[model samples]
Target: MVLRRIFPAMYTAKDSEPANSKNGTLYLLRCVFFMGVRKPPKRYFLAYCLWSFALNLCSTFYQPIGFMTGYVIHLSEFSPGEFLTSLQVAFNAWSCSTKVLIVWYLVNRFDDANEILDEMDKRITQDSERKRIHEACSLSNRIFFFFMSVYMMYATNTFLSAIFIGRPPYQNYYPFLDWRSSKWHLALQAGLEYFAMCGACFQDVCVDCYPVNYILVLRAHMQIFAERLRQLGSDPHESEEERYEKLVQCIQDHKTILRFCDSLRPVISGTIFVQFLVVGLVLGFTLINIVMFANLGSAIAALSFMSAVLLETTPFCILCNYLTEDCNQLADALFESNWIDYSKRYKNALRHFLHNLQQPITFMAMNVFTISVGTNISVTKFSFSVFTLVKQMNIAEKLSKTEEEVENLY
Candidate 1:
């Protein structure tokens, strides 16, 4: 519902036929602009970049950092169960903070990516292709957000529990304010944390959605681009000269697509690497919570939280997997083209193009590993391994402590 203005889940035929798809992009940018996540307009003669930094901290990076300040500092004092909670929160903090830091430092690269996307959008001349891209983007948004909303339901538990239990979400240290001194102070603090939570979730969603959404749009463009490749020299009405011109245009568009990929490499590589690094531990802790927590609410939270994490992280791999496949399909597409009778120049260009596509266009995570669905399985296996080790250690500790108690009694 929140993103309906930008990308409607259910739109009629006429509704999809806008003057341009740039409106949705504009609407999203306006929302992110107000949040100070996106770079401010150049028209603002003296815009302070610090506002974006401040907003990033408050919106996404602060709460977990705040919670950890108390729990993490005195880590040796907490029991295993207590420490697990802190660890879970810490892993999450690392993920969110790293992404926030990336945004703060790399906002301009992000702007480049967005502008390139709009340029790519303008290249889609056919109404049918535009509608197809529109529907694909809309479907991607709906699926992404539906899981996100479910996870938000899980996150809402923190706020709900705060309201019912009359305590803030975290028992973290706040050096600036004595928020726990009185009911009013506590109430005010809770209100602020709630505000922070809403803002943080929204910004984090946008941060993630930006690159992924742009890439998804690029992927859609390539899908059309591939079909266009297959249609080369098919129109006999056009002379050989005309068909050759069309091939040149196709090659130019392909280069634009490649430039888009080059721009996106910087935008996604580091983000994906850090995200992959955390998934193992985060999933391990949450899986442990589901297995160990006797409380129904805690178990549900753990389960839902695990589901949300998977929803949030896994689809990137899945999407990249599909995108990789789409890119490879271009080779076959060009080969299948009716270029048998085309000019020598067209065949030479097509041959070079097919050769480039021959080496499958796979994106890597920080140049470390290929982003694909296989990574998802590997992550899951690593998480289960961590869960097993942690589980056995916890059980062994309980048994050893029990024996010590018996010995003392004896």
Candidate 2:
């Protein structure tokens, strides 16, 4: 009886092995080749561009509506009055449009450059490993473009629409639709912002980690070239001059890799600077403006949560800059480390790191904000679960200070 009960499990495993083994190997091979699987097709590229353009067009049309509506409404309604309200509306529209344009243009340029790099790298036929690197670069660029395009477009569109469309902003004036504390609107806002957070986190992961992987590949190439040089020198028939020439060529390739590292520095630094400055100014201004009219406590809670997110993300952005700089310096020193017998091990370690690269750090980061959805909150007081969660954890003190400074401005 026991054997009969166990028979199905045994047979299931027996029957599954051939198919599972073949499929698993195939899947592993694809992952080994591409590092990450291929992204959606090229048609998605054109669709993304068009979607951004459409979003910009929509925002531009509605800017006038927000301005006109705020103007027609009496000045006394808003705490700062009508002129200030209209100005904030117009400014928000302009700020949002600018953000969309900036994100769109930067992401587009990175996509083009990464694709070119991948093609160039693909031509290096030392082994399957080289091909895998190129394919990974290509796939990562595609994924980055997809995430950023979706994030910037949707965020800009939602923000613009909320601020400008009809009475939402004029009535709520929440800068964002803060429905998490509102029973009627909680579910919808949660779904939307959760998507937004996912995209944002994914973009951050790609921008931060892609270069690190590429740097690892370059380091590996350096080590391999060093080995080849040693082998050439050891050969009984090889000429000293030939060995020197190979060494020179290897050094040149190393320099080329360094140049790629240098190129990424400005991209990383500029992204951090521009994103922080723009988000900081816009968010600070919006929160202060909102507090002037709405429930001050609710505004405080909402703005505090926003600042927490902005601050927590700041470290990742700064780390991107740090990695870019560190990689350049490290790439230079890695060649020198050969004398100490550390170069080979270092290179091997980097390879292992690259092998485990796509481990969902981005998805995990999004959980900071995502899982807060539908948690216990005070609907009457308009406090959010996000605020409670972060407060309990005591994150983002600098962000809290900045929020206070901005709030004081109002």
Candidate 3:
């Protein structure tokens, strides 16, 4: 399949292999989905735009209609469960807008994604430790794809439940405000909305996975560079001049890796920031909905959906942490090398490299929040706080209603 050829692995097959032979199923999916092409064809570009437009339109309207119906018109006053549902609906609508923004960012900055892939391809093909790095990257890609597949299954199941079981055939949760009540009309509306959600989810996975691949490749390069640094003066057959040359080459590689990290920031930082920001709210609302209606079938399905959302948002933090740790290890690796045995000039070069490594290569979210394990911790804490607050409010509202009923009895 063309998709399989386009979507699977970052590294191309060895030149000795037949071009036709390289088009394996797994490889093509990896290429098409995550490892985007340098120049996407016109049709692909148009499809991307159409998908983005649909998502944007749906998300853009979803929130306003939810607010008007839930708050302004007080439609959710009938029950606490309905109120919780309203809040979750509003939050999901808002979060979808963020997805649209991320999709837009990914489409606009696709060239940067292609460049990262190209750099990875070069390193995997040319590096002496290609086999090790290739294996590591392949492992990471598999883990990523496995997570995505699980999320997709969960999402599909949730959507199907929402369509068949959660709502009447001639109605949906979509705030279409005014429309014909025909079953076919409702089905068509629900189908378009479902299609938009699926498309956005797929795009979201692709955009997020691109950064994962880049970070993995970057970590691989750093590992290889660290090994070279460690082996700098250990080769007995190499002369002083040869050792110095190798040291210079290692310095150059370090700089290239750093430059690549810089190039990656602009492509992903804003999208990651938005993702982190929204995940907290989404999680909070989902939790509130689950607690309010624990036995409700719709709530159970929504819980599954939100679990998938969390899984999707988590890799940004994990991969960023990995990159930071890998970059920091460069200094330690260099320090542990046989640098003391080298000439003064070579020692000076080591000093320069160590100085560079002092500032660890860290990814930022929107140039403000650093993406790390700590950020993940902070987001979790924030989500918990929001959930607690919403839970308390619900409790208080219930208590107030109980008191009102008691007064009427008196």
Give residue 178's lDDT in candidate 2 (0 to 100): 46
Candidate 1 achieves a global lDDT of: 0.66
Best by TM-score: 1
Over 1-410, each residue of candidate 3 has an lDDT whose tens digit, in order, gives 67546654544434343222112123323433432322345778877666445554554445335445446554423344445544554555455456545545555354454454455445333434665555555655665566567656655655565566433211224555332466675567556546545544554555556566556556656777777677678888888899888778777777667666676677577667776776777677667667655346656666765766666557767877777778678888888888787789988988987888867777788888888778877786676788888666777467448656856776
* Stretch of 10 with least lDDT, candidate 3: 19-28
User: Sorted on TM-score, highest at the top, how do the candidates line up?
Assistant: 1, 3, 2
The TM-scores of all predictions, comma-separated, are 0.83, 0.40, 0.76
Q: Model 2 — which ten-residue stretch has the worst lDDT?
A: 371-380
Q: Where in model 2 is the C-alpha error above 4 Å?
A: 1-53, 60-96, 102-108, 119-243, 258-273, 282-316, 328-410
Model 3 off-target regions past 4 Å? Answer: 1-93, 102-110, 113-128, 166-180, 395-410
Model 2 scores a TM of 0.40
- Separately for all candidates shown, the number of backbone clashes (residues 3 or more apart, or on different chains) is 1, 0, 14
TM-score of 3: 0.76
Q: Residues 1-410, candidate 1, lDDT per residue (tens digit)?
A: 56555555433234346424333344345546756755466876246466665666665667777767867554444444434544675576667667766765666775676666677776677777787677656655555566457656666765665456466554445665555578877777767766666666655565566555666667778888888889888887999788888878887887777777777676577777777788888888877755664146545556666776675567777788787788788888989989887678878977887887777666788888787889877876788998899777787367447556756776
